[model samples]
Target chain A: DTAVSQTPKYLVTQMGNDKSIKCEQNLGHDTMYWYKQDSKKFLKIMFSYNNKELIINETVPNRFSPKSPDKAHLNLHINSLELGDSAVYFCASSQGAGNNEKLFFGSGTQLSVL
Target chain B: AQKVTQAQTEISVVEKEDVTLDCVYETRDTTYYLFWYKQPPSGELVFLIRRNSFDEQNEISGRYSWNFQKSTSSFNFTITASQVVDSAVYFCAPSAAGNKLTFGGGTRVLVKP
Candidate 1:
């Protein structure tokens, strides 16, 4: 069984189109996160939810929003996607909100804004 | 502020050759956690190892070994007898507080048979 999974493995949309990526984890973790990997392969944290509560919100624009219906799911929605939004979005989960805990990541959703 | 730096951008080696990926970090907090993650072409991030600040001991798991040095704020990963399956992009991440992780630029390793 895949511990962490995300849908829409590949997405290609227009510049002004909006898209959403769904993520689910069966690890029964309390914390879930969304990370963005740019062309340089630099992974940056976008948002984190601990038990459905917003914890960390980076400098990401308001266009990108993360919603976690429960501890097992965290979905990312991007509004008016731009060229810069073309990157790999990864979903991850951990046992708790502790910094030392290991994280299990999904295969990732590749978003391409044309 | 916490930062993880991976100096090597890419490393290519023949099969069975050992390779060491360097990681240096800077953080104000005395207590933090360091981690190593591998991302193959499949785009899945695989957790390799994790080391807490208090644990400076070196650990070995099969062909993978990690060295954590608090004195230099460095946590390095070494792979012995690397195979083609070992080719991947490795990231060094350090988490300070609130479970926030800062990932390095990553080092891509290509193992040629």
Candidate 2:
């Protein structure tokens, strides 16, 4: 069984379009995160939620929003996407929001804004 | 801000040879976690190993080994008797007070027969 999974593994949308990527974790973890991997393969954390509470919010644009309805799910919604947003979005989860813990990552959602 | 650096962008080795991937991290937190993840052509991030600030003992798992040194703030991974299947991009990640993770640019490993 997959511990973490993301839907719409590949997303190709036009500029100014809005899209949402869904992520779900079955590991019964309390924390979920969204990370963006740019073309240069540099992974950066965008947002993190612990038990439905916002924890870490990086300097991401307002167009990028993350919503966690529950501890097991964290979804990312991008509004008016731009070409620069084209990259791989990964979903990760951990046992808690504490430090020194390893995260379990999903297969990732490849988003390409044309 | 915490950052992880993988100095070697790419490394090539012959099958059955040994290769070491270097990772250096910078963080102010006294306690943090270091991790190594592998992403092959399949594109899925596979968790290889995790080391905390308290554990500095070198760990050897089969053909893979990790060395963690707190003084130098380095966590290195080595693969002994590497096979062609080991060809992949390896990433070093660091986590601090929160669940957020900062990953390095990654080191692409190519194993040739």
Candidate 3:
């Protein structure tokens, strides 16, 4: 079974379009996170949710928001997509926050904002 | 605030060669965690290993080995007898207070057969 799964492995949209990427983990973990990998393959954390509560929010733009309705799911929604937002986004989950747990990551969603 | 840096951008080695990826990190927390992840062309990030801040011991698992030195704040990974299947981008990361991972600019390894 896939531990972490996400929808729309690839997304192609124009500027000003709003889109969402859904993520789910079956590992019954308590913490979920969103990370962005830019063209240079630089990975940065964007958000983190522990048991559906927001824990860490990085310096991402306001257009990007993450919602975790439950402990098993964390979704990212981007509004007014800009060219700079084009990158691969990965969803990950861990056992808990600051508990020295290894993360299980999804296959990632490659978003292209034209 | 924690940061991780992997100096080698990309490395290409022939099969059966030994390859190492270097990682340097900076953090104020006396107790923290360091991790290594492998991302293949398929785009999935696979967890490799994790080391604690206080443990400077070197570890070996199968064909993989990790040498962690706290004095230099470096956690290095070495692959013995590299194979084509070993081709992937390796990331070194440090954990913040909230378990937030700061990943280094990955080092892509391409082992040609």
Candidate 4:
């Protein structure tokens, strides 16, 4: 079974289009995170939710919002995407909010804005 | 602030050769956690190893080994007899309790067979 899965493995849209990526984890983890990997392969944290509560919010733009319906699911919604929004978005989950816990990541959703 | 630095941006090695990926971290907190993650072409991030600040001992598993040195604030990973399957991008992340991880610029490894 896939411990963490994200829908729409690939997304290509024009500028100003809004799109959402859905993520689900069956590991029963309490914390979920969204990370962005740019062209340089630098992984940066965008947001984190612990038990459906927002725990970490980076310097991401307001157009980017994360919704965690429950502890098992966390989705990312990007509005008015721009060229800079093209990157790989990854969904990860851990047993808890502790830094010691290992993260289980999904296959990732590649977003491309033209 | 916690920061992890991977000096090696990319490394290429032949099969059966040994390669080492260097990682240096800085954190104000005395107690923190360090981790190494591998991201292959498939895009899935695989957890390799995790070490706490208090533990300075080195660890090895099969052909993979990790060296942790709190004095120098370094946690390095080494692969012996590397296979082509080991080609991937690896990240070094360090974090404190209840805080988000700070990942370093990944190091891409390519092992030619």
Candidate 5:
């Protein structure tokens, strides 16, 4: 069974379109996170949700919002996508959202805005 | 701010050869966690190992070994008798607090047969 899964493995939209990527974890983890990898291959954290509560929100724009319906699911919604937003978006989950617990990542969603 | 750096962006080696990937980290907090993840061509991130700041002892598992030195803030991974299946992009990460993870630029390994 897959531990963490993200839907819409590939997303292609226009510059002003809005889209959402959904993530789910069968590991029964309490915390889920979103990460963005740019063309330079630098991975950066976008958001984190612990027990469906927002724990960390990086310097991402307001157009980017994360919704965690429950502990098992966290979805990312992006509005007014731009050319620079084309990158890989990964979703990960951990047990307690603590320091020691390691994260299990999904296959990632490749978003392209033209 | 915590940061992780992997100096070698790409590496190529013959099958059955040994390779070492270097990772250097910087963090203000005294306690933190270091991790290594492998992403295959399929683009799925695979968890390899994780070590905390307090533990500096070296660990080995089968063909994989990790050397952690707190003094130099370095966590290096060594693969022995590497196979073609081992070719992938390796990422080094460090987390000081919370659930956010700061990942290095990633090192791409290509094992030639």
Candidate 6:
């Protein structure tokens, strides 16, 4: 069984369109995170939620929004997608919101904006 | 700010050869955690190892080993007798006071037969 799973393994859309990528973890973790991997292979944290409460919000654009309905789910929605938004988005979770806890990552959603 | 740097963008090695991936991190916190992840072409990230700042011991797991040195702020991963399946993008991430992680520019390794 997959500990963390995200939908739409591959997403292709045109610029200016909107899209959402859903993620869920069966590990019963309290903290979830969304990370973006750029075309250059540089990974950056976008947002983090602990037990459905917003915790860490990075310098990401307002067009991107993260929604965590519960501790086990975190969904990312992008409005008016841009070409630069084409990247692999990963969802991760850990038992606690601490540096000491190792995160469990999901198979990334490869988003491609044309 | 927490930072993790993987200087080498990519490394190529022949089969059965040994390879080392270097990682450097910057954190002001006295205690921290360093992690390594491997993302194969399949797109799933596999957690490799986690090293706490207080523990300076080097760890070995079968063909994989990690060298963590706090003085130099470096955590390097060495692979013994690499195989084609070992080819993947390796990421070094370090977390400090915050719950989030600062990931390095991944180092892609290519193993040839």
Error of 4 at B81 (Å): 1.3
Candidate lDDT values, in order: 0.94, 0.92, 0.94, 0.92, 0.92, 0.92
Give residue A1's error in model 3 in angstroms.
Answer: 2.1
lDDT of 2 at A103: 82
> What's each prediction's TM-score?
0.98, 0.96, 0.98, 0.97, 0.98, 0.96
Q: Across residues B45-70, which tens digit of lDDT does each residue of candidate 4 receive? A: 99988888897889898998999999
Candidate 2: residue pairs that collide: none
The TM-score that candidate 1 achieves is 0.98
* Per-residue C-alpha lDDT of model 6 across residues B1-113, encoded as one tens digit per residue: 98888999999999999999999999888988899999898978888888999999999999999999999999999999999999999999998654678889999999999
If you assessed candidate 5 against the hidden native complex, which CAPRI class would it receive?
Answer: high
**DockQ versus reference, model 1:** 0.89
- Inter-residue clash pairs, candidate 4: none
Which tens-of-lDDT digit does each residue in B1-113 have in candidate 5?
Answer: 88888999999999999989999998888988889989889888888999988988999989999999999999999999999999999999888578568899999999999
lDDT string, candidate 2, B23-71, tens digits: 9999988888888999898888888988888889999998989999999
User: What local lDDT score does residue A4 receive in model 1, on the 0 to 100 scale?
Assistant: 95
Per-residue accuracy of model 4 over A1-114 as CA lDDT, tens digit each = 999999999999999999999999999899999999998888999999999999899899999999998899999999999999999999999999997989999999999999
Q: Candidate 2, residues A9-44: lDDT per residue as tens digits?
A: 999999999999999999999999999999888889
Tens digit of per-residue lDDT, candidate 5, span A15-113: 999999999999988999999988887889999999999989999999999999999999999999999999999999999778778888999999999
Q: Estimate the TM-score for candidate 5.
A: 0.98
* Alpha-carbon deviation at B60 in model 4, angstroms: 0.9
The Cα RMSD in angstroms, rounded to one decimal, for candidate 6 relative to the true structure is 1.2
- Label model 1 with its docking quality class: high
Over 4 Å off, model 2: none
